[model samples]
Target: MRRHARERPEAVALRFLADGEDVVTEWSYRQLIQRVSSISRRLAEAGARGERVILLYDSGPEYIAAFMGVLQAGGIAVPTYPPMGQRPLSRLIGIIQDAAPRFVLSTARTRDTQARRVAELSGHGALEWVASDELPTRESYEDVPVVQDQPLAMLQYTSGSTGSPKGVMVTHANLLSNCETIARWLGPSEGRRGGMWLPLFHDMGLLGGVMQPLYSGFPLLFMDPMYFIQRPVRWLRAISKHRLTLSGAPNFAYELCATQIPDDELQGLDLSCWSEAFCGAEPVRSETMQRFAARFAPYGFRAEALSPCYGLAEATLLVAGKPAGTRLRTFVSPRQEDGGEASPEAPRELVSSGRVVHAHRVRIIDPDTLAECPPGKVGEVWVHGPSVAMGYWGREEESRQTFQATLPDGPAGYLRTGDLGLLHEGELFISGRRKNVIIIAGRNHHAEDVEQTAEAAHAQVRKGGVAAFPVTAGNEERLVLLVELKPDGRRTEAEVAAVREGIIQAVVAAHGVRPHDIFFGSVGAISRTTSGKLQRQTTRQAYLGGVLPALKVAP
Candidate 1:
């Protein structure tokens, strides 16, 4: 990367906007190389060489500089978002303690708290902390290049939905391969500009916003993720203002932007330059994409710009994506019937995430036996390639289960993605999660199938009301449905009873899962991540917290 920057010193590498105005802060390839060198020397001076260094800062020029600096200084980088203040400062301290990082680099406002917490966790009198703003400069120093095959970076903590966050160790070769594959799939030409508001802590954000641009020698535009959540249209406006050729978000982001942005605001926006709009990180809803495109198409947004892709942190960000400049493909049922078997044809109900990226080996396997399933047969989706990460940092058991597997043709060695999906004519179609599946009466039931049924049963429960989780008591495995009522609308006991019955009946009819528990609570009671994924474990914890009320149902 340093060599590439040195070769193209005069090219613009990064662009950041502190304010909403058109004025921007730019960094040429040469300037970036110089800054990274200086920061790397400072890191070495702070005793951070060949050691793990944790970075806690918002998205900005300094954040990128610090990240590059850590790698350049022969140290591993563990980057995370700033504390949200919900959890005690001890959480961050515990992570630092577990990793035993040599030093912590953070913004000025968080330096004291971060240092104090680290001290408490380590029980040391003092700890090393550097405010990103106050780091010293370095006079020309030799660049220490790391081996691409060895671990180049470490992302502490998984998505945190399942259990304790595990640090995913990514190798330089893994990172570079994935970025190059993504750039190739997107066809990022010279002078191509990409805009992103996803947090750098996330794989998608870090790889797409930072590494991709650097590897492709294109300029990347960055903004705070919070700002995009608060005002999504601002993302589109930013693309228009910067003539951004590529941008993307999870499915919910597009839904929020479509639902929140007013028609008048949409009328004034220009999105002609937007060429590649990758959507992933969550289930890609056909309705969400169609509505978003329809609502914004008049503003010069092309339907061909929508690129639905799939990836994960374990793969160093990218794996499979739709080809650039192609309209998204949808698999629809050929029959006009409302609920029909999904076929490869472009039916009204079909939704496709486009074709797979180059060089990625994706196969849908039977979850129980690990045998390759034929096309259109839903099963666990497994991918094997150079993009796959080395393994979890300190978890051998989990690494073995997730990162090591036996294929029929090769010696057993592949990552068990744990995601359920199928392939049809070379396109991957995700179904649900293997862990989240609920088996009732020896029949397989998907949580999304039950949740969607519940949503359709009552308009009040339409998005906020339902959660389906599998539970085991003794020898029996049962499904549990937790529903939250609308906040402003007060429901009588009869209404509550009706909702409970409706949910149970809906689930049983749709997926043959007779939920053993139908728990109801207040609206906004269900916890979810920033991306709107239901925090089932958190809800289960809350249930165990003794906050839910019991309701009697007819026998």
Candidate 2:
């Protein structure tokens, strides 16, 4: 970074729009290097190198600089999303307890607005808040960077499927290795301008979006995620206007563009410059890929540019990605992957996520026997490489269980992804998470499969707003389904009851087991992590606690 600043002092490294202003805040390489120097000084004054430092800033250049500063200062950066909406205090308390950081860096605006929430979380400790912008810049600055004695760099908390968040202990070497691997896969297109709206707290947003550009020497543009949520078309417009060569989001974001963006609203939009539309951080639905490609086809969005990727935070954000400038291959058949057998069922298209990146090896293994599966057979996905984190912080046994798994015939121990998938023609295809499999009458059923059936049963129910989990009923584990209804008030109560009926009948017909309980709720009732992935365990906790504001409950 210092080298870049010295070489191209005026070059824009990152750009973000100011609040309510048409003007943008530019962080030139020179200015960014200076800000980083100031941040390092503040950290040096407060504590030692290996201590944890939390970041709770709004989207801007300062946040990005502070994150780099943490690395430069030799502190482990824990990037956290600012709390919003109801029960914001409770939202951060768990993370606070888990992180146990000595200092939190934030802006004055965030401190003043969220004082109460901060106080509540810090009541259990003596945590300090360091003002990032108020820190003084040194009069004389040399490009001599801070020396690192420890291997640890950052602690990326995982989005847990069945429990509270676990901090993945990431080292400095891990970040560099993973960034280089991702840079190779994403490629350095002719004009390497990157633009994305994914939240900074997400691994994709931070590691892939922020770090990749810096590693690859590309200019990046960031927009407030809330802005994109308010208007999805702005994402494309940003790419179109900026002539961005790369940008991406989850599968749901693509589905939103296809369904919500009307024809007239897409006037004068051109997406031809977007050569790499890397989609990951969640399940990449084939229907979503097809819809988005078809919707933007007239605007010069090539079918070959529709890239679907597969990764996890445990692997430092990227495991495998489709190579650039190639079309994806998919299979449409009524087959349940990971089960090792074909079944008569509803057919769905499964898109190939291409190959694993440089130096990273991926294996599909039988979970029980720890044996590798063949090219076309489904099994658990295991990752082995330098990009994998050391282990989870403060949880030795838990970390060992998840991060240290061995294959019976393989030499290298692999990081068990806990995700189910298959390798066909050397390409990866994810099936689902292992913990999310719902068993009914001794038959294995993926929760995603059941949720898809429920979402397709009624037009009133919002897609991607359904969660399927199991709850103990009598002596057996019975399925519990939660569906989010559309926000429109036109759907009557009787109509809602009929929708519930339709959902139950559809699940029974498809999965061969009826849900013991069904709950209908408003749009935001379904819980999600900061990265926008489904928090099924939290939703189950809410359901069991009777806190779910259900419009109607049926048994």
Candidate 3:
């Protein structure tokens, strides 16, 4: 990266728009190398080398500098997302405890908030909290490049299915390989102008927003994640204004922008330069992509710019992506793909996530036997490549399970992505997750299936009332359902009674299991992750908190 920066030192490395001014932050290869060297020396002098440093800062030039500084100093950089509120602060502290970092780096504005929380978690002794503003400025130093295969980066806790968050250990090689692969996939014809509003803590933000630009020497346009959430239109406006060539988001983001951005606001926005709009981190819905493209088409948004990619923190971001300048693909079936059903003729839908990016090898395999499934057959998706992480930090068991796999034809090794999908005609189509599958009496049913059924129960159910999760009782698995009542609806005994009955009957008929427990609540009471995935553990926690209203169940 330092080498690339040196070669293109005069290039606009980062473009940070602050307070309506386009601040073109140019870093000629020489300047970046100098900055990194100075920062690394400062970090080393601060007793930070060979230890992990927790970065509690927002996305900006300083954040990038500190990140590169950590790498240059041979320390692991664990960048965290800004705490949402008090609750999330506690969660962040828990993550800090798990990571056991030597120091916590933050700006003055964030110092108190971060220090107070770290103190609470560590009983005021676990780590030294250093404000980035307080770090002494060093005059100069020579650039020191660390070994490529060394563990130099740490992606701190992003919650997955399990409520407990663990840091993903990303080596320098893992990061550089993925970045180079993404650069190649984007091609030289398409100017690699990255435009993103994802939080820097996220893999997409750190790798795609920062490292990709650094490695490729491409210009990046970044904004606070809050800016995008508060006014999603700004994201599109930025892209249009900058004539950004590359951008991306999870599925919910596209939906948010499409729903939030008013038609009139989109009128004069010219988005013709927009290309390689990658989508991932959540289920890529074809309908959402179509709506976004159709709505922004008048403003020069091309359908071919949609890049529905697949990746995870374990892989250091990208695993597989649709080819550049192509629409995303989706395989649809009117009926569910049953386990026993053979050679099912389901209607295939081409939504195009773009072609696979670079040297990554992807395959669909039977979850239990690890046998390769034929193309178009729904099974677990597996990926193998240089981008795959060393493993979860200090989690040998999980690392073994997630990163070890045996192919029928060859040596025993591959990343077993718990995601369920199929490869059709050389393209990957993700269906859902394997762990999310609910099995009742030896029959497998996807959670979406039950959620859909509960939603269709009645008008009230459709509003917001349903969640089905697999619950294990002694050795048998059962489904536990929770439903939230309409906000304005009466919570009287009579109303609760009817609603409970309707939900039970609806779920039993649709999923063949009467929920072991049924709880009712007001609309919007159900908690969800920032990405819009239902927070089952949070809901369970709320239920345990005695906040949910109990309704009489039919015998």
Instruction: For candidate 3, give the lDDT of residue 103.
Output: 77
C-alpha lDDT (0 to 100) for residue 306 of candidate 3: 88
What lDDT does model 3 reach?
Answer: 0.69
lDDT of 1: 0.70
In terms of lDDT, the poorest run of 10 residues in model 1 is 336-345
Candidate that beats the other on lDDT, 1 or 3, i.e. the better one: 1
Residue ranges of candidate 2 with Cα displaced over 4 Å: 19-21, 138-140, 160-163, 338-346, 437-467, 470-555
Q: Report how far off residue 335 is in candidate 3 (Å).
A: 4.5
Model 3 poorest 10 in a row by lDDT: 336-345
Q: What is candidate 1's lDDT per residue for 1-555, written digit by digit as tens?
A: 566665776778888866643657888777777777777777766767567888888788788888888887767888875665533243455566556676777878888655665576556434567776775454343453433433566654454321134678887678778877887787747757889988787777887778888877778888877677677788998999889988898877887777788877765678988888888876666787888898788788888888888777787777677776786777653331111112222233445666667677887788777688888777777878888887887788889888887786954557777776667788876654556555443233556656667777776674756787755442234677787655544457777777778777765554444678877766566778899988765665566566765433324
Q: Which is superior by TM-score, 2 or 3?
A: 2
RMSD of 2: 10.0
Model 3 stretches with alpha carbons more than 4 Å out: 19-34, 136-149, 160-163, 334-350, 436-550, 553-555
Report the C-alpha displacement of residue 231, candidate 1, in angstroms: 1.1
Q: What is the lDDT of residue 308 in candidate 1?
A: 85
Please list the C-alpha lDDT of all candidates, in the order they appear: 0.70, 0.78, 0.69
lDDT of 3 by residue, 1-555 (tens): 566654555667777765322554545445555666666776777767668888877777678777887887777888874565543465467677677788777777787766765676556466776666665554344435443434656655554211245677888888889988887777773366888777787777888778888776777888777677677888888888888888888777787777667777777788888877888776676777888888888888888888888787778888878865764567674432323222122343435444566877887788777788897677887888888787777788988888877676755558887777777778787765555556443234556566666777767653545776655442334677777755543346766677668877876654456777776655666777698777664565456557765533334
Better of 1 and 3 by TM-score: 3
Stretches of candidate 1 exceeding 4 Å from the true structure = 20-23, 88-94, 121-127, 138-150, 161-163, 332-350, 436-518, 521-550, 553-555
Best by TM-score: 2
